[model samples]
Target: MPRGEKSAYTDKQKRQAEHIEESEREQGRSKEDAERIAWATVNKQDGGGKKSGSGRAKPH
Candidate 1:
């Protein structure tokens, strides 16, 4: 994947990032910085979109 591309992320992950970004922005972060932090948080929580062979599992 290219830098900054988010095609591997799930819908819920995207939503989480959006919420995080908004929260960061409200706390005075720049848009770019907030987005970066948000994505990092989602990655930290979801392990970067890794999947099991069986099927989609429940979110923690």
Candidate 2:
């Protein structure tokens, strides 16, 4: 559960991040910035990694 570790992310999420990163790079973002934006985007969409069993549900 280390910061910046992507092991908890699912394959689809990883692919989405990669695609987003590439798109960001195409739009003239730096490597680090693109990666940051990509992961942030994924986090916004998915609310973080889906592989973990705990904290996967939202309280009603």
- Write the residue-wise lDDT of candidate 2 on 1-60 in tens digits: 889999889999999999999999999999999999999999988889875566666745
- Model 1, 1-60: lDDT tens digits are 888889888888999999999999999999999999999999988889646578777676
Q: Please give the TM-score that candidate 1 achieves against the real structure.
A: 0.82
Model 2, which residues run further than 4 Å from truth?
A: 51-60
TM-score for all predictions? 0.82, 0.84
Predicted model with the maximum TM-score: 2
Q: Report clash pairs, candidate 2.
A: none
Worst 10 residues of 2 by lDDT: 51-60
What overall lDDT, based on C-alpha atoms, would model 2 receive against the true structure?
A: 0.93
Best model per lDDT? 2
